[model samples]
Target: MNKQPQGNIFHTPEMFRVFDQTKGHKSTLWAVVDNDNCPLALLLPVHVTLMNGLLRQLTTRAIAYGSILSVPGTAGQTALALLLQTYKREAKGTALFTELRNLSDLGQPQTLLNDNGFAYEGHLNYLINLNRPAEELLQSIGQRTRKKIRKGLRDGFVQMSEATTLAELEHWYEILQKTYSNAQVPLADRSLFMAAFNELYPKGMAKFLLAQVNGVTAACSIELPYKNVIYGWYGGSDRAYSDYLPNEMLIWHILEWGANNGYGIYDFGGAGKPDEEYGVRDFKAKFGGDLVNFGRNVYVHNPSLLKLSKRGYEVYRRFFIR
Candidate 1:
């Protein structure tokens, strides 16, 4: 019997570069290389912080996030499978679970994930095609949205500015904090956005935008460029200026910016479920983007630990965060 040849496996430096450029999540990258030393597949595992308790341990998740490059055809699947097996073997006593959020259009990844013991969790995302001319793109938006944009400009005295300094970041983050507080949702640490802006702005991978009313900041957004798509990562508006429609203007400005910059698509980030009546989804739908359902895929290494961690996190969210 002949033994199968083993390919080279190691972490690439580019992973660190990516880790710095996006949402400030602590991440490590792993890749499977071919015999010729070319990378066939890449995996990025992110560390998620859960509640800390002595017998109830929480797990870190490995997310694909923005980039999940792979070779064409089944070679990618083979590389991913091999990487998962290696990860499971090496990740003993480390993380309680692992997940891979596949790219929106990654052929058919569920088969490979299922074969590797991963369960599927469906999610909805909205994508705006930016290949068309700006005029056509504007015309495609809902009439009410267009009116709101115009109203924001004409009545609200809204002005859009590109943020370039830490002061601007602080302003954007303050607005974010208010927005999250108003909604009663738990916001991530401010350090995450700060780190992301500090790293990605210099690399030209991210943009922080602010919409002001009469020189007062009323709305803000963070746009990230990955591959050929621009993602509207985070956005918020002042409820005081709700009648002015600052958010509508902010979104329209983002779309125009994407078109002018030659980006092929504008991702509205994640929407809610298909049958759900979510205000966020309804707002995104007015922009004339397509709704996609390429959900998250999860693979658990230790079911018992994962269950305990989830229950603990739920309690934390309900009592402490809320």
Candidate 2:
């Protein structure tokens, strides 16, 4: 929920201005208050959706990310207390996979979310503190992967940022489509990303990376810069880049930039689970990332409601996602 913008200082630049306008179908955000009810952090939800608000669409639950309820210094506790108060007082509804991503305070959020009746399917992420030398960091990769990194350098790949133009984002859209199509996973909404990129490009708190060779785009990634930490949010690469190790080099450049820019952590982001994404897990670990079970400690308010609705989701997943 948002009131008219009053130019609060605690607002995170990472949140897009479009989110400030509240144009999407269904979105949740954090709000801060002072002793006199002053507003603080009203951030974008970790999850994005278009729900009917009316229970007409209220038939399931979902996991969400990036749902941050922050209040300058002491209001974090106040914000959580407010969330519990509102959740306890609100009417019941249904949802499908309301995920809360980018929660740094995993313990507090899991407690608040569980108390509010949300279940954490899991938290997916690996964070690498970019506090070490680049060469020292590079040495940590698996032998074969390390060799691949060296080969990538030999193949004439170059790493650069802001080379990622509108054309590249569109190309990435195509690459991502191909990736999802090949993997049979759902593609994220394109307009949502377009809006996101348009809002956060260049000046604000966003950065894009491009791996190029002979002036051709090979691998690319995007990072969300906030509070001196850059999140390795999204990326894709052509098959050739994998052979050349441009992906590794792209990250190498990114990490270098982060270090110089005063950033402390390079969140390689989530890799699902080790069992499901062993390759990804191994790949990120090569960069000195550590696994963090991000969203496991939850407190559920209505266990019966969640249990009762599982069958609907079971059938829906089998029919649609499966």
Top TM-score hit:
1
lDDT tens readout by residue for model 1, 193-297: 776676677777678999998899999988887556777878888999887778888899889888988988898888966777789898899999888987766
For model 1, give the 10-residue run with minimal summed lDDT: 1-10
Q: Write the per-residue lDDT of candidate 2 for residues 5-99, one digit (tens) a residue.
A: 21221134434443434333334454556678765434343323333355224343332335545443446655766755564344234343344
Model 2 stretches with alpha carbons more than 4 Å out: 1-25, 30-32, 39-47, 50-64, 70-79, 107-113, 120-124, 158-164, 213-215, 274-278, 296-322
Q: Which ten residues in a row have the lowest lDDT in candidate 2?
A: 1-10
Pairs in steric clash, model 1: none
lDDT of model 1 at residue 256? 89
In model 1, which regions exceed 4 Å deviation?
Answer: 1-25, 51-56
